[model samples]
Target chain A: MKLIMNLMASILLSVPAFIASVHAETAVIVSLDNKNTYTSIDKELVARIFLAKVTKFPDGTTAKPVNLKQGHYLREGFNRDFLSKTESQLSRYWSRLRFSGKASLPKEVNTVEEMKLAVANDQSLIGYIDAMDVDDTIKVVHKY
Target chain B: MRIGSIIGSVLAAVLVTTTVQANSGDLNIYGFMSVGVGILDKNEVTIEDFEGEGNFKQDTVLGIQVSKQVNDNTTATGQLVSRGSSDFKTEAAWAFISYQTSTDLTARMGRLRIPFFYYSEFLEVGYAYNWVRLPSDVYNIPFSSFDGVDFTQRFSIGSLDNSIQVNYGRLNDELTIFDENYQSDLKNMAGISLTSTYGDWGFRIAGQRTEMTLDTEVDEAYVSAVQVATIAQMTHSANPTPQSGVDLQAAASALAEAEVVFVEQRRIDQGQTGAILLAQQMNLDLEVQDEFAFDGHVADFYNAAITFDNGNYSFIGEVTAIEYESGLLVDNRAWLASFAKRWGDTTTHLTYSTSRDVLNSGDSGKLQEALNLQGEDKSVTLGLRYDYDVNTALKVEAQYHDEIMNRGVEGDYAMLYSFAVDVIF
Candidate 1:
């Protein structure tokens, strides 16, 4: 009976660790190139680029910010990590832009893999995705 | 069409669109109303033309906005404004689609505010600002819009907040009064605004550029007179057109020719000091020759504000400066200082403010500070304000003007007093 109890206890301890590994998913800022590396961006320029109000980085390179499909986890993660606005307020801001005659809206993709693909292809692109989903095809600039 | 029919059409459309986007009962409705009177003392006025004693007035404004969420990431909003244009007219204040990328980064590709002045964002919603009207001296740029996009991002440092708003768009409009050209060129307009706020202090620096084709018509008389004189000169040089004076005749003819044209064209092109770019080799028609000139302007505006609360009183002061590289009519640099004292649970508050439109530009469009000795120009307004509620107020204002451009003009000083009651809902 003592040996059976020890085996059961050991199984329970390992079960939680297995579940943690199964559910763990990291979030990362996926950009088009090495320019947006975490160590490279100053806090000020990062805010500007993500906000859509800035098109150029501090180094004079143009920035093309993109986002995940609406209402996705990567989208929510982006808000929590970088942008602090709610999705609805952001919509209203876009409405304001439709008639303001400034710039075009950022491109969008439906999934993390799609966003990563787009970001990797263009040096000007900026987007976010599930960190675990990123592969050698894309660069992980900043993760949260 | 009747107002009722217009209402019916809108309601029907809303009902139809509601189904696809949760047309259920998520919609909300709101309205507003206001009325008031003006009591003024017209001191030393002539009763021959008209007369009035203590006037009573009424004003009405109404609007309804339909706002609802289509999903977690998008919302649709539309507003209909009525009787807001002085005349009985209905207009669309805003109608657009909005979608967000994230909480912090969002882009609006439809129509939106150009973010020109401090109060520009809330300019239409009177209740969003202090006073019955925005300080006209600073908030008076004409229509602001274009087929454009707007982007905003906000980040914080320690406890301080920093925000940047950028806009780019093309605009086409005609400016009727005192415009060198009818359009502000807005053809190519884009600007960036950077603002920082820490505690009660905030500062803003914004710059924008506009280019135009300089498609303006010249003063007909001025141009014609020049042409006729040139003709007379060549004729005189060739045939020596015999004048009443070998010397005096020539001078007399020149002066006479100028007088006839001046009398006919009383409204001279006032903005330009002399005949416009005619001598600059612009496109001029031999007979009413029309030429195109290239004129563009870049305006840079900056403002700073400080708000502080002491006990139960709130004090806010705003200072703004607008520098125009070339084209500016009036009210460039202005500063207003206001102090308010609250009483009775803030039901009644008394405030005093002094506003001045200082002369910072060479143009007289800001006539109150223009270098004109004689004219109905603007001046500094020192007024006492009393508010009975958040939406109503009584104000008595007095203005004092000084004439700095009078080399020998008669009246050098002017004073005006007015009392008005303003309300909003």
Candidate 2:
């Protein structure tokens, strides 16, 4: 009886955590040293910045957007949920923009650690991290 | 052409070497390739050379692009593209320098794609669109690029993002028209385009005007038409052929009688008169001269497009119209509407397109038919695109053209089928 009760309790506790893992939140981040007069940003502005439609922040400073390498889960989640674009669609958009000489693909990092480090060092760079992985070195402007 | 092929090979080799050597640098290299096979039910060659037998030479293409960031606000880009339809002859498609003037303004100068259609900028990149190819009816144009300078200004109005682009250019090159080579020059070319987007809906409209000159081939039909007109003018002198003299007299009398009847009919039909009647009287001439030559004539082009895409389903409607002040190339309008649905990794699309020659010469009956130099096309296409991976796509398309009219000859129907594999790296 005791073994069965313990097993049931553990399963009940892990179900929520499993769901949470599947639906992990993503945090759009900036560097801690940045003082661009932004405590939080809107999704539309984020989309525009990443798409290269707007090259500057509200403070009139150049905004350099960074991205994770292709096929990264965090990148995929950020693209779909935040940018509202699938991988194929995003790639197609970039292909059009790049070939037209209108825009270039954002710089890319290989891993989440690298992404965090890159953003923490460059005041102009904007990046994203998994919500749970957010640290003091980065400032989360928005989460989704 | 041979030199161009050598350069293309060198570029390809450089691309391969660079890919193997580096992934992090200021200099960036990009490439795209498509291999295709297509066949048509008719023996005649259509655009892209789809004929009776399956062939792989028409749709195969390879492109390489290299771009270097010259500064924080300036970039230099160069591109080379080779097409199998042109016997795999490579060409430098674009070489340009761009500067970001402001957060929402950019200026570029050098070789640039002619922004005549919605897909003009990225027309060679098959992986950018869902179709195996763009609809031919609306995208038909002889030239694709020009030496130009352009400025783009982007702004927002409420919730809508808008942009306006202005360009000035010139095109001087050798081109093939009607299977005959001609020295073509388009001078004083200028254009403006406006594009706007609101959520899932997108809109664009553009207009361009230019003065053009071309060395046209003198064919037998033109010679015969000139001879007939010359004979009609000299009917009072000795005639070479009695039958032609009598025929000309008969035609003249018939035209006079028809003109009288047309005046009465016009009075009854639209109640139009004065200048309209004079215009109608001018159409009684049996033959028009200089109708096929395009020497120092002004031409205009206009296009409008509306698009909607909400993730899984999309729709597009576009129309293009052209008018030449004087030429055998009559005014024409072409339009297309397409719908696509995506399920998982596959997308299916259906499109309907049509084009017709608009007679502005005021000619009627057989005269109008004789002067029609282009074919009228109405087609329906069904296509499927499968995402093999993030960097590759496989596509199959079938297009059925119905009741196509070339000059005065009408063809029943033609079916073309094609398959392509496109990859980008």
Best by TM-score: 2
Residue B334, model 2, lDDT: 95
Clashing pairs in model 2, backbone N/Cα/C closer than 3 A: none
Distance (Å) between predicted and true CA of B216, model 1?
Answer: 2.9
Candidate 1 C-alpha lDDT tens digits along B180-226: 22544555677777777554355666766555433443455555555
lDDT (C-alpha, whole model) for all candidates: 0.50, 0.77
Chain A only: TM-score of every candidate? 0.72, 0.83
Positional deviation of B266 in candidate 1, in angstroms? 10
Least well predicted 10-residue stretch by lDDT in candidate 2 chain B: B266-275
Query: For residues B261-297, what per-residue lDDT tens digits would candidate 2 score against the true structure?
Result: 5444321121112222322335454333344346677
**Candidate 1 i-RMS:** 11.2
Off by over 4 Å in 2: A1-20, A33-40, B1-24, B44-48, B217-292, B361-368
Using all chains and alpha carbons, the TM-scores for the candidates as numbered come to: 0.52, 0.81
